[model samples]
Target: MDSSDLAYDVFSRQCSSRSTLEHVTGRWGALTLGALHDGTFRFNELRRRVDGVSEKMLSQTLHALERDGLVLRDAQPTNPPRVDYQLTALGREIAERLLALIHFVEGRQGEVLKAQERYDAARGGL
Candidate 1:
């Protein structure tokens, strides 16, 4: 059954929600959303904020988020043609939750690193 026939089953292979979940949680997607959550930003500004993301990948991520209705793109006609990106209401809500997870990860990074070291030690060091 399709997502509409159900409750947007993320576990279903054919469910569109699966793709949206991936888009939001993917490396670039999550970072991009977090960066945009700070405020609206121009393309280059966002690229700089996201760090390590290539122009092409950032463009694709933005397109996917926009298609999912989680991001808004405002293009202005001007001398240089400014294009800005920001989170929509739905995007903001999702981003808030994502940020909570991110903060939790950050807060536990030391513990996570210690666990990783223990695992690596047990494995005789990778």
Candidate 2:
């Protein structure tokens, strides 16, 4: 049919789901999505908000997100080469879902901690 219809079909496929899930749920992906949930940020700003991520890791993660049509990269010609990043419409939707996922994980942290403690004791790692 048309581009819009083609896009819908692709999005409806199982493969698309798997691909998007992999990008959005990876260790760095989750953090990056969460960081962008607030608003647009420069490259260095994103790195700072993402906690322990390194420059290389951040670069790789951003590239993956950009390739998947989740994040937008804006490079401006400036004295120091300013680069800014923000979520696309698709990215914003994904970020919202990621925010809920973050809430879910945080809510379960206590239970998870207890389970980890029990497992550690059983395994003699405690």
Where is model 2 more than 4 Å wrong at Cα?
A: 1-17
Highest TM-score: give the candidate number: 1
Error of 2 at 124 (Å): 3.1
Q: In candidate 1, list every pair of residues with a backbone clash.
A: none
lDDT of every predicted structure (CA atoms): 0.95, 0.89
Candidate 1, superposed: residue stretches over 4 Å from native? 1-6
lDDT of 2 at 115: 99
Give the backbone clash total of model 2. 0
TM-score of 2: 0.83
Query: For candidate 1, which ten residues in a row score worst on lDDT?
Result: 1-10
Cα misplacement distance, residue 22 of candidate 2 (Å): 1.5
RMSD of 1: 2.0
lDDT of 2 by residue, 11-124 (tens): 555546567677899999989988998999998899999999999999999999999999999999998899999999999998998899899999999999999999999999
